[model samples]
Target chain A: MIVFEDVSHDYGGGPLFRDVSVRLEQGSFHFLTGPSGAGKSTFLKLCYGELLPSSGKVTLLNRDLREMTRDQLAETRERIGVVHQDCQFLDHLTVEQNVGLPLTATDRPLRESDVSDLLGWVGLGARADALPPTLSGGERQRAALARAIIGAPNVLLADEPTGNLDWEMSQRLMMLLIELNRMGTAVLIATHDLNLIRFAKAQVQARVMRISGRKLQLAGAEL
Target chain B: MSARAISSLVVPGRGQSVWLVTLSSAAMAFLAVFALALSVTSARLAATWSDALAQTATVRISAPPEEMDSQTALVLDVLRTTPGIAEARVMVPEEQAALLEAWLGPDLPLDALPLPRLIELTETAEGPDRQGLRLRLAAEAPAAVYDDHTRWRRPLVQAATRLQSFALVSLVLIGAVTAAMIALAASAALSSNGQVIRVLRLVGARDRFIALAFVRRISRRALYGSAAGTAVAMLALLALPQAGSAVPVLAGLGFQGWTWALPLTIPPLTAILAWAASMATAFRVLRGVT
Candidate 1:
């Protein structure tokens, strides 16, 4: 549902990537890997309309990112879930409140049962009332994931979702992403974890793309 | 979203403590009322000054006491003959003494002092020929000096006008400061709850929706504060000693009749100010977050 046509992004100094074209189709699983300072986060930001392409076009759901109004982008964001690497959460809010924040902000109907059930799914049910700052790194990541998917978005973009977690915690988080992919939510995750990629290769048919020479190059089936 | 959603989102001073909001509002309300009183009082003072001095003209004659009586008689005769001149009366010794007593205190011995005999003049709906009257009095009695009270009256009116202008300026400045303070507080609250805003934005919440959450909170707080302030101010104004019938200046300082309605609007005005300030700050902050 997201297409980047010759999209070149720059942070005012120089191009982050040049004339990179890619299409993320529905119900597909893709993993983007690159070394540190390879602009992985910036690329994901472009997909969500958080950062506009410096040149060319990035379109989401057939609408140009450059042409959509802020309101329209917000609406589009509801259809695309994003789990940030840092797991942004309001420190003052409890885990439940932080997860339910999207519902409150959008004036959506929220039920206590629905919140408990979602927390249960993410294994954060016991920590529902705990404040975000008091939670462990893995718990915080799960909470962020719960918040991202609470709106039932069709597309999920995770930027280093397991960056702060241990191997076991990362496996749990990756399994959740796989489950979402199985449920027909198009998933694109950016990371530098080769072990995680190898782990995913054993579970499903997934494509691997690497950032090389300032362009996205699709790695062969060896990945 | 419906008003119910807005109410839930705002929670009326929940971001801050209820007690703090109440205390701030009460203090602001208290201050606002006094500002309103001062503004209304100054406005009334200006109107009274304008009304008292507007249609009236005075004639003064400076002449020797021996020639004063004859000069007064001649001036009276000329005034009677003059077309626009209504009626002129010579001030009696007691009346002039009482006039001087108002300034010099009641104990002043007017008879011992060589005070000039003053003649009080009145004009009709159509005022008299001020220039012609002065010329006539000068020619008939060279010592006769026509004092039309313009010198003192002009300055008095100007001072009242300046007071009124100053009061209005103060009201505007107070409103601006209040708005700025509320906006700063809102920005801090929003930034502190940055993740909350981001989640809201991610969930399809429009900027206006986000802004309304803060706007409603500030507006309600401001309303409460200004209302309480206005009421206290009104009570303080009532407690103030009325300038007795003898002291018109003091009497002129308090709100009367329809003027009392003016202070009633201060609360709503403050609420509107808070809404505008919060909305602007919220939108600007949201723009940065996105």
Candidate 2:
């Protein structure tokens, strides 16, 4: 679980949030909605220990994020999966190799069959040997999702996971997220797509929160 | 760290920078192997000079033409009675001329030069008491001077000692230069692989894990380069001209007996040095990042 209490973050321009507080509980699905430059990505970064709150404390895994060392932050991140808008794969490595990188870092043994099954799940089984640069926009997103969940993390945070996808491709990615959520992984998707949020609401019970005037507000039944 | 641990995370596919690192490491290791060989040779030469020349002495008798033969005979008598003198022999004009042939040519000019006669003395393992021998020489053969070879040989010994020191210093400097090159190359490698590092960090790689990926790549390449360099150096050493009895100057220029294995240690040492360089560079780059 990640909790931000009165968190304010300034990126040299000024404070983006005056007093923002949010708590994400276990087994919960959340969609962070806001316009461009609404600090949606920054919120995900805070949850994964990439950024620190400017004035308040952000707690990760029941511990204050500010008190954690860099190494401790890395350890905490092992239990949290993160996906960026651009699938940041090692461009030189193959698809399957990129997916199994986290396991190498954690000293976990990688079984060949397990990796093949995971790639098959993401529909990247045939393209496992293809490099990231060779993949399409939708394929790249799917690969990023596979890499994120390969470590069996407790929480999943995707920042605009379908930002560059089409209607059909975006729906396919959304289905994968929902499936992972069903398997007991907390899911958080930050995006500006109200249609995707609406589709998610139809598929499962989800909490929609939007940033309005540097504050967090829960959305009603209608977007 | 083992090879399987890295699992080719930072393999040669990154860029041409890996090639540059390999070439640079090979070149440095080649130079280092030569420096090590030179250092060992100098130490051996210095030891040979000291041990062989220390127990020998020379006696120069510059007497009047009339007393020359008598003083030579007296010096030999005194040398024979001395407790530590193992053997003493007066050198005939022919033997002395042969010794000086390099400077004075093989022509017939010995009769014209008023050259003093020389007596070569071989001392026992315990060596002669120089002060006691000198006192005996003063009493029996006042015109004969007991030259223990120290006055002339000390300077040569000193030169060899200085040469050994210089070679050792050269080896250290070469090592430092090698380390600097590897460190710079490592920094470049890290810069080229920045995206890989970022992705690894995003997936929760500790700094050590991220660094190990690069370290293993760089160190493996270094080992390859060093092994090649050492093999070439060993072949070169073995192919060197052997020193026969006619060429005493070349006698101590190379490794003798078990010392031949000393230069073989260079490749492994170079590998260790390269590992150190990579570790240093990896830590520096890791520190600069998140």
The model with the greatest lDDT is: 2
DockQ comparisons of all candidates to the true complex: 0.29, 0.53
RMSD of each: 4.9, 2.3
The sequence of per-residue lDDT tens digits that candidate 2 reaches over residues B85-165 is 999988898898898898868885888888899999899999888999899899999998988877666787788778778
* Residue A160 Cα positional deviation in candidate 2, in Å, after optimal superposition: 1.7
Docking class of 2: medium
Which run of 10 residues does model 1 chain A get worst, by summed lDDT?
A100-109
Please, what are the lDDT tens digits per residue for candidate 2 over residues A1-223?
8888989888999867668888888878999988889888888888898788898889998889989876887788888998898879887778887888777776777776777898997778999999999999888988898889888888999998888788887887788888888888889999989899989888988999887788878878876
lDDT of 1 by residue, A18-58 (tens): 89999998888999988777788889999888898989899
Local distance difference test scores for all models: 0.77, 0.81
Best by TM-score: 2
